[model samples]
Target: MYLNSIQLQDPNHYMQIAQSSLLPMLKGALYYTLPLTLITFSIGLILALLTALAKISSIKPLQWIARFYVSIIRGTPLLVQLYIIFYGLPSIHITINPFPAAVIGFSLNVGAYASEIIRAAILSIPKGQWEAGYSINMNYSQILRRIILPQAVRVSIPPLSNTFISLVKDTSLASLILVTEMFRKAQEIAATTYEFLLLYSEAALIYWIICFILSIIQQKLEGRFDKYVSH
Candidate 1:
């Protein structure tokens, strides 16, 4: 009725762990992962739209800035980038906590990549569309806000949703900086109880469930949006 390494009078230590550690760990994941993915991805999408516009702008400086940002983020590993922001920033006067720093780094990285997706979508919109928007007395911003961006978003939805799903899983990496997400909590429980297999497996189960729910939402959104595609 006890683990060899400890003095606990519980016959169902393993089963108890499945209920105790897993249920809350899943909630912790939802707490961090859902907000991080949704907030960061939404902000990133806005930044991406601006960056994409800058990339194609007639102004050379804006174009250069967009290209450089995309190059640096895309060329480097996200973990290293995160370490620099989370750990390296404190070397100077700029000190941020692990969670905020992770969010910033993730949003920036998503922005860089998503900018390209946005740019490609915008570029794919026909010249006639642009001309038509102008003929309708739409200014540049108005045309983009109304005519262009709507189509671009529709075209980019599938890839952008995939990026969001990946971001949900990637949020686990924030645990390395001591964010105490689901996986980190799982590790803590495993270390405390020596129930490594049980706790870790439960953590994996939680991740799968979270991702599955996101997948269902993504599918429903896709179906709803696809109705507009051919019409």
Candidate 2:
């Protein structure tokens, strides 16, 4: 197979092999990449919100826990984190499958980074806003729900969108843990046919296309959020 593929390594034939590989690679994205990103981001955002709030809370223990979590996650490499979850945990008999492990690892990684973004956005609000809400008889929860979160969301949009875009790209790392995402599919095809360059380039192109579409959506969302501020 290697010799056969090498014999056809001319431009036209190379492209044909890559083109044939495209559909499977793309299907991997649809099934694994997109779903992993969406699920991980959704969970991560929730974790971020909680961690951000805990960091800002007056309670000392919550603050410490939040800080520690952010510190550990941010200080480590994501690949190592994934390894701990997928490979290292079984030392204590806590084992997880690859997809779940990837989800958990990516969520923690995104959560830690996103928490700082959210915390900064929340802190950027003036003290006067809290006072104003209090003057109107609003409790902290009510004010946070009605006033603070809405405004903070606008401020958080750009960075949070950026984190999400990064997450989309980072999902490729899931393939390392045995999740059959697009990059993994490319690797499999390349291994069998010994067409590493073409297959890898094709995979990169697909990732670029996905990220490009995400950037466009980010801009539109930012514009829409801006309208709310304008009024």
Please report the candidate that would top lDDT against the real structure.
2
- lDDT against the true structure, per candidate, is 0.86, 0.95
Candidate 2, residues 67-162: lDDT per residue as tens digits? 999999999999999999998999999999999999999999999999999999999999899999999999999999998998899999999999
Model 1 scores a C-alpha lDDT of 0.86
TM-score of each: 0.91, 0.95
Clashes of each: 0, 0
Compared to the true structure, candidate 1 yields what TM-score? 0.91
For model 2, what is the alpha-carbon lDDT of residue 117?
A: 96
What digit string (tens of lDDT, one per residue) describes model 1 on residues 85-200?
A: 98898889798887798789889989999999999999999989899999989899999889898988888888888888888888888888778778888888888889887887
